[model samples]
Target: MKKFIHEDFLLETDYAKELYHDYAKGQPIIDYHSHLPPNELAEDKNFENITQIWIEGDHYKWRAMRALGVPEKFITGKATDAEKFQKWAQTVPYTMRNPLYHWTHLELSRYFGIDELLTPESAEDIYAQCNSHLKKPSFSTRNLVSKMNVEVVCTTDDPLDNLSHHITLAESDCPVKVLPTFRPDGLINIEKVDFTDYISTLSKITGITITDLASLGEAAKKRVAYFHENGCRLSDHGLIHAYGYDYTEAEINKILSNRFAEKSISEKEIRQYKSAVLHLLGQLYAEKNWVMQLHLGPIRDTNKAILTKIGINAGVDSIGDYPQAEQLANFLNRLNNSGSLPKTILYNSNPSDNELFATMAGNFTGEEIKGKVQFGAAWWFLDQKDGIKDQLDAVSNMGLLSCSVGMLTDSRSFLSFPRHEYYRRVLCNILGNDLKDGLLPHDMKWIGKIVQDITYNNAKEFFQFPSLVENLSLKR
Candidate 1:
């Protein structure tokens, strides 16, 4: 068998190796969506050890360790850092066939130069080596980002966020463009338990009294303007599915008033309110020429007991099976009819909706824009190799895969940058196999251009971030 993680790890053929190394590998990253904290990058924090950097805030690993019967303390509880690393080391070999196995080894090899398979036997030595490297200034958060050759990273932020850290990074001339993406899920999800508290937070941020739907709209408008002023050109939403309700302003106002007064609203009213807010936000995004991202189909916080112990983003969520196509089409059509549909990306956590989302995106292509509407890269549970192939096949069959802006980490870890590399390899292998199998012609130049675009070019062209470094390939 081939050596593990050699130069051509996932490349099964000569064509795949050529496409990856010569074209896809060197492309600078444009991480258009991620949950990386702006404050850490601003401060250039140096992680103390492997566990601190790898395990902390990484729910993927937590989920795997839990499956291996690793206890709460070693995963997310009050265990020593070394203890946590040990437990994860013990769990790594069991992750074979899971994307976690590849991701773990990739992170290790790329970041720490450790190519040996991780096991309980090698855990201590590997941990010590990574910790030694972590102590260096070159491994600081900013340097880590630079080392990965990432050109831009758009961090997810709330409407009420002050963006003070982003401002700090911008003023200091940090090379990587750490921009903000407006994520207003809490503001739109009025049925959430903390909806009133969130509204109060928004009111304080905007200095607006949000007693009615009009005032709430005013608050959101101000926040959107503020985000734009801070160099934000993207807005994101997480939804069970898209909503498109035709409700009068009076109805929305009543729903807002009821929620504000500690009164209950019906399920239908909740849908109406969410639809109204989404439409208004879509209009704002279009007016400002911002890219809107919709991350659909996640059923979050299913295990209430687990949530109480570890809180949100701690690996208790699963894919949702909500009806998507009709509402999604209506939502986009509403914006398109108003001549205010901005560039959009639709990401479905559930793989079964791949074709539905792909065709839905194809329906709204803009006259003046190339790939104005896109089926986003496979996300969350769908980021694995098989899932990547599924998404690519669907998009190629139903939409324009060439114009697609490619992968984003959608992660909270710095080491997760290798995920882009993983995607590039998978993409190159898929295209190369097609060539060898007589599916595609032997035109390497044309295929290489496509690989480069998906790896970096599409995102650079698609997003309108003000200070995005001129695309390096274009600069040549």
Candidate 2:
């Protein structure tokens, strides 16, 4: 048999086959950033059907459905599960060369052990077979996480969340460390769709009348404290740019006060106002030793009419054409130079910012830095093979390979855990090919150890989740 001919995972020789095959097999996954439901992790549900698990919240599938000329009744409306699955199956063949194409077949091959390509012809059998397995008890959320060797899964949570669910899940014996991150884009925005509603909710939660900018900041800090009490070690923000235009507290407070009085603020002034809040938040994060994640460069709520009906993040956000590097670099350096910078992990949506973020991650290291700075993996729109490979190459070429954490799915689909397997295989193949070409002295054991480290160890180490790895070693 030809080596790598029939193999789906990129192993190509006897030594290569033996070494990578066993190694690339599911090891513990450390998902650093994801949108998984905290309540579901707390409950750990078994799926009722493949369509329920895969189709329910998959915006990618929804996009494909939209492209396939599938009606909204079937795409995002009140269609039956069976109808939605049929629509998705019909659209699958048209997704050729798209990352979804590889990801779908890969899930089939990896999770279900089915080699047949999915198309309109084989859709029924494939769906039925997947649904059959979904009925089994082992297909539950907790079990599936355990199956994929996920040790730690950190989910995004709003600052206003009570996080009682996260505490309950963490206290359970499920062994997956499901942590919450503080995301406060709504709190920082004066232009958010439900800004008034959000402020009311925040006021109710913190018992502080947010009559002005100072009170607003105080209320947000009070809520952030509650999040920290529940073991939140990280905070996240999403923005079109890192607020670079500098301003004094008085100037920003004037902007906020005007905003509160329903006076229109200029786009330039709005950015400065947001920047002042971000700077203060950075100070707070540093004071508490919390990691800060900035997810930047996406133009949110693009389709105005669709946004009016469907709402934000319901598949309306698109990549912005803005240059992301300079402002982001300035934001970090502004904090760093002032000695108030927290350990930061930046996720950039613009593909052009890859090299810029690469150098940014390497900028602050060693004992001088209060804590480490990091480049987060390819995220959201860039969670595909080509995009991931680009990020890996940029980070490897510029920074220490050992410092780069492997991958995270950043997906809403329950079946997306197979993505860890996909990333690992690509990672191992890249390193393996490099060894074959005499790039790093042809040391298989050392290289294999590094490959394993990137896939599993690096993430845990980077996230400071060493207890789980100690437990995994005990299991071994």
Cα RMSDs, all models: 3.2, 4.1
Off by over 4 Å in 2: 1-8, 12-19, 22-26, 211-214, 366-371, 465-476
Model 2: worst 10 consecutive residues (lDDT sum): 467-476
Cα lDDT tens digits for candidate 1, 391-432: 999999998789989999999999999999999999999999
lDDT by residue (tens digit), candidate 2, 1-476: 43222464555444455446767564678887788998887887877777888888788887777877888788778888877888888888899868788788877775677778788788889888998887787777877777777778888999878787787776678768777788987887877667778888999988999876688778878877777666667888988778766788788778867777778889888788777778878877877778888888888777797678666666777777777767777777788888888888878798888888888778866475322777778877887777877888888888867666678878777678878776766666676666667676666677767777777776655555435433321100
Per-model TM-score, in order, reads 0.97, 0.90
Per-model CA lDDT versus the true structure: 0.91, 0.76
In candidate 1, which residue pairs clash?
none
Model 1: lDDT equals 0.91
